[model samples]
Target: MNDKQVMVKMVFDRWYALLKNCDTLLNSLTDEQLLREIAPGKNRGIYLLGHLIAVHDDMLPILGLGDKQHAELFEMFLKSPDSKSTEGIPSVGELRSHWSKQNVMLKEKFDGLTADDWFGKHNSVSAEDFIKEPHRNKLNIILTRTTHLAYHHGQLMLIKQ
Candidate 1:
């Protein structure tokens, strides 16, 4: 392979690593702890888990993997009055299953893309409202999203620590 192939492989690898780290972090918390609100004003693990899933679910349409049927599910999360309401928060097992399924779906989407597809322009209206970036070459966007997730995950972990 050439430089481009190498770069894409690296991006995919890094994405996998990030996702694994996210899963590990989430798995570390007990069900009760996952539901506990660590800080008075902070979101609990359940809220963060739901938010992460919602974000990924929102990305599905932008990635062209499916229709926008789940868009409202994520929208509800972003527009919800309180993150701690537990109205839509899944159980720990349910969250774990959801995470696994979404992870697989995202990986499939990434793997199915051609070199040009990664750099092509795609419009994504997820929790962030509006986002447009090169779909074929999305290393920067992946890094940015991963960083955001890590930051929030760190905050959640610190609260428990």
Candidate 2:
């Protein structure tokens, strides 16, 4: 395969694997379990899940995929610190549904990109800069988000016990 094709495959594989692992861990939890905090003041499982959903939803714009599908999520999850407030934040079931839909939409958009588009400019990278540093292309976003997922996935594990 060409370099762009290979890069896309690798990035997608790793991203999918990490997402699956996170989903499995998340699905195993009860709604009440998701509300429990990892520590006294730290984020709860539900909060983290909403944060992840909002972050991933934002990725649509950041990756030049499209406008965000859930703009309200940014305020509810990203704009504030972890809250048990539940005033605006979605419930566990709602967040789970949002998470699934956002990911599926992301995957669909990702699949539509041409091989060359993978090496094209992303959110911040200028055309010149992208050519100079191809590693900063769209695929790198997946790598960055993969690490982010792993970080929160570790936190999600703490809610289990």
Candidate 3:
């Protein structure tokens, strides 16, 4: 095991551990609880769940893995804040299913990447730009998204009140 491989492993470990922690927190909430806002009128627990799904779902194409599965979620969860009326949002059941499937698929793709592959530019970057900005790699996505999950995990704790 070389230094690069060890560093990559450490990052992946943090990503996986945080993801699992967030999943456990999300699972503890009931469907009714999910519909309730994390704060008085802020984003709902379920909205945050779907937002996470949509963001993770996007990583597939961004990382050159494959097309994302839940484009519809973007309108409700990504494009805008949680609405007072539940017009275009997916059901809590459907969001949970999508979240599970999206994570499993991403994990498979993530597992297959070699340490060298992790340092390669993602699909969204140009080869010229990548040459100048080598840090815009696929592994960076995992690091950033892990932090994102952690941020939401703290917000989710507010839902219990």
Candidate 4:
């Protein structure tokens, strides 16, 4: 592989590591633990999990995969207030199922992208603009989302504090 391809592979490996760490953190929690808040007024573990799933669901179409498996998630997890304000967020089990399904599918789709595709424009960038700045690519999207996941991982830890 060339230098760019090697770098891209490193990024992908790092993303997968972050993802695995998140899965490990979540799996280590009990159902009741998943409902605990980071702080008295902060979001719950389940709420954060749902929010992560919702954002990653969005990455589907943006990455040229397919539509969101749970479009309804936007309202509950993305747009709505935290678990403190939301009235009827899905149960922990349901959200866990969605998280598992959506992530598995996303990984499958992401794995299908060629090395060149990683350096190509994601849906967010127009073709003309991408041509002018090829650095704004799908790999950048993964980098952004990895940071997002790690941020939430920290919050997840606070539930136990």
lDDT values, one for every candidate: 0.67, 0.86, 0.87, 0.86
Best first by lDDT, ranked = 3, 4, 2, 1
lDDT of 4 by residue, 82-160 (tens): 8464357788889888888877788889889888889888999999999999888999999999999989999998876
Candidate No. with top TM-score: 3
TM-score of 1: 0.79
Q: What TM-score number comes out for model 3?
A: 0.95
lDDT of 1 by residue, 1-161 (tens): 87767776777787778788777877777878878776777777777776777777766666666864345456545556346766755576777688788788778777887765665545543434333422333444565667767777776685467
The lDDT of model 2 is 0.86
| Clash list (residue pairs), candidate 4 | none
lDDT string for model 3 (26-112, tens) is 789888888888888799888999999989988989999888788887777888978855666788888888888878888899899
Query: What lDDT tens digits, residue by residue, belong to model 2 across residues 1-161?
Result: 98778878888888999989988998899999999998788999889999899888887887888898889888878888986776667888998898888888888998898878876778977888878888897777778889999999999999999
Least accurate stretch of 10 residues (summed lDDT) in model 2? 82-91
Q: Which 10 consecutive positions of candidate 1 have the poorest summed lDDT?
A: 127-136
TM-score of each: 0.79, 0.92, 0.95, 0.93
Kindly report which residue stretches of model 2 are placed more than 4 angstroms away from their true locations once superposed: none
